[model samples]
Target: MTTVHQLSSPWRHDFPALNTKVHDKPLVYLDTAATAQTPLSVIRRMNDFYQHEYANVHRGIHQLSMTATENMEQVRQQVAGYINAPDAQNIVFTKGTTEAINLVAQTFVKNQLKPGDEIIVTEMEHHANLVPWQMMAQAGQLTIKVWPVTPSGELEVSDLKALITDRTKFLAVTHVSNVLGTINPVRDYIQLARQHQIAVLVDGAQAVLHQQTDVQDLDCDFYVFSAHKLYGPTGTGVLYVKPGRYEQMPPWEGGGAMIKKVILPTGTTYNHPPLCFEAGTPNIAGILGLGAAIDYIRNIGIDVIRSHEDNILRYCLEQLQHIGDVEIYGTPKTRAGTIAFNLIPHHAYDVGTFFDHYGVAIRTGHHCAMPLIEKLGQNSVCRASFGMYTDQQDIDCFIAAIHHIKALLD
Candidate 1:
């Protein structure tokens, strides 16, 4: 493994929050999986939009509105290019990944699934992916099936195979487990669903930040992720629907921006799928910031960032293994840059509080995957996730804080 100092992350300085301190101590941010720190480039781009070129897009004929509309549309193209989609028309902007998944549930799933049809989901899904289907199933009298998780926090392929029957109408799963740091075999799973003629939707919130994603290569029916996790602004995300599915689905929401003609008494005619989904004034500045964030990632090279994160995860795991009374979770052959562990003598929340005193930030609790946590026979765990700008010192500090907390507890 290469030393951390030898790793070149010239873009580290682009994030201003890293240099700031909390209580006069340097802040060590280890919560990138939840939300990443935005780069200065994205921030500056959004500021430029508000300061000089602010206007309602696609509504007015004025010069400002035209310019805003052009920028917004160009960002949509950039987003499509980033994910290797066939065209920009396949991308639909939304509030975030949660909303995108809900859109699919309401528009595509509701339209196709019958009363007895089943939707298969894994035990490792966040609530955003799980609850939407569960609610829809309840309302429509559809059945919800789950794929079991192995002891190592991976989905059992055999179990998944057994669950997929002719009754299965759709399969939704996460590309990466947020709490377990497990990298699921999404491409293989999609292929299996294809064999069964089941549509597949992938939750790419965690995977997109750690690696490069190509929707064409994955061959999924739909892919969704939030920009906030990718060093971009909040209130912005994307849903990528295959061209065939895009044409088949109905509109999820109804409002001014989505309609072509609204008759006063009798009927309303809606626009095409993407615009029909976006009901009103969209988050134009947020999308601009996302575009800037994509530019930053491309400039720094995602491949290089992924390599660096892999090395850091390995180093963090090795260091934690050396410490006494620390139990690590999710030992997958392929994993992301998240580490979930527990101290023997202390609750995970207590451990988190101790780390806070040392200015070390980490997440604790069920991590929104209550079913998986119960399956692991643990109430909660402490998590430390990595990002492109994370360094060896941050990992060392986290490990030291854990040891300190353990000593006091013991």
Candidate 2:
């Protein structure tokens, strides 16, 4: 019951996709947790790069290469600064969060764990965070431990005491639950993991736009996030390790930019941290887009965006709660951007499709976390997530659409 006013997102105009119309209705994009619409600034930046500054970085001595190299490296520094990392050198570019986590799982965790070692993860984790460990466990013969979720769909970090045994080698957790919008108390779990000398990886794909991230403050061993989630281009991601942690991991992939010297007869000496981890020519345009995205977030201010999103979250929840037949999932103690629910008799896909025909976009089904949806006693749930460009009008349109769909279905 916070004050409700005609609050519109000031930056909505910056995203041209929001202006799209379907069947004469304006697009009400509410699937941001899945993927947000790219801002014009980011689009323009990528377009400009391809038009003018396109070149392979780290391997060329020419002017275009140098410029591209400088800009790409500057993005690394920008990402480090954005997350408050101790140094930009610790950041490695990957395809996306999925690759970043898999990089760690493949390079760092795989080498360190023995047959009896364990890796701890929460029930609320996205499949990107969960499946890699499952695969690793099968490959390395390691035990995968689950940190159970409360009824409200939050990790019971207090339960960490029992899970982190002497055999625990690593722990991976998501900063925010994509399904529940629950913000886990990551600091508490990280601290506990540190006590047991277990390395931790935090997946921040759903977190970057919701609030400011300080990896230094969180003291996590490693952090991974996707650029597209933060209004950047796709095919670009960040994997940040602590100052000295990168040395512990050998290169995950091998290709052009990852090595310093390649002797056909002898062998190859790899590049240092960031470059060593980034194999091949890399996604030059996407990296530049990520830089522009960081610039966009800086100019908008994450704190300002967060306050606006929090207000919208409260407003949307209050409105949805009014529907007696609607059953919302994951009532977290504290939530940020996403919400999932089911309107009793209607299938989630039916609700999503009906809304889509009317120009509203929402995510339906397990959301890549089938175990969690099943744990909550459902096969599927509809999720509507928010972003910087989402506003009251979008929510109102969604609500109105939902009521119409409910009536039609009933």
Candidate 3:
């Protein structure tokens, strides 16, 4: 087991809002999985870019434009390094994870999928990962196959062989479930997909915040994640396509930046994948802030963050387990910080609202995994997600609040 204090996060001080009090009490933030609190370093980096280096990238010959372009490209390189992508050219910035997934759906899947083709996804996927393929399957006259999750909150790979046939065109799944906190065995899944010659798209929105990812090692054809969940700003995320895949996939959108030349009399020529996909004026400041966030994580080390989170998760699980009338969800062997649970005789939203009264922030409702919630025999759940800065005190406060709420409700 890793020592928590030895792995103290150095970037904690960079998030100024953590020091602020809510309702005359120190705020207990437990919704990091939805969106992490941004560090001051990242905020300052973005502010500096807007204040001085602001300009439209990849367009003008002026000095400011060149500087902005250089900065934007530098961040791309940083993101490449952050995820251990083989080349920086594989990193394409977008609005967030949803857009990144849609990019793949529009560009690659749309072109490749056909009637009788099938796409494989898990039962625990978020709507972002689930809906795109559903729409694609509907339009292309394809079949959508879902892999089963065990009652113990683990993905059942026994059915995988049956699911992947010659008709399998693509496999899309989450690296870590946002609601269940179950870390899926993505490498094994990727290997299985490789055997069937099926391309895989792994949604890293939840995993990227906790796990140390190497896209090359995973060997997935494509990976997507949002920066906000990783302590960066909102409106910034990445889609990393393998070099081979990137070369084959076309641009999803048409705009000023995506074109190399336009012949009105004939046709239009498009730029290569990364540039071709980024259609309009990109989120320059958000991209810079994302780079700073990656820098912040590197300075602190991912291993350290993972260890700290695991410790806190274990403690929270133990504490919640001890509470009477409380039932926890997703008891996976190797879970992350996200925990979903409910109290008997109380609604999840009510519990969430009660916790809010004590300045404890958590997520409630279906958590954008309505299908999974139905599978779990519920409509909604209370979710508490931890970050690197989250410690034992936050968990204690949360547990105490739950106890108090339960008492009042009873």
lDDT of 1 at 304: 87
lDDT of 2 by residue, 339-375 (tens): 9999888899999999998899999999999889989
Q: Which 10 residues in a row give candidate 2 its minimum summed lDDT? A: 1-10
Model 3: runs farther than 4 Å from truth? 1-11
lDDT of 1 by residue, 1-410 (tens): 55767444566788899998866779989989999999999999999999999999879999999999999999889999999999998999999999999999998999989999999998989999999999999999999999988988898778888998889989999999999889998998988888989999999999998998999999999999999999999999999999899766888788878999999886999998678889999999999999999998998788988988998888888888899889888778899999888898689999998888888889999999999888878999888999988888888888888878877889
Error of 2 at 42 (Å): 0.7
The per-model lDDT (C-alpha) reads 0.90, 0.90, 0.90
User: Tens digit of lDDT per residue, candidate 3, span 120-178?
Assistant: 98889999999999999999899999988788878877788878889998999899999
Lowest lDDT 10-residue stretch of candidate 1: 1-10
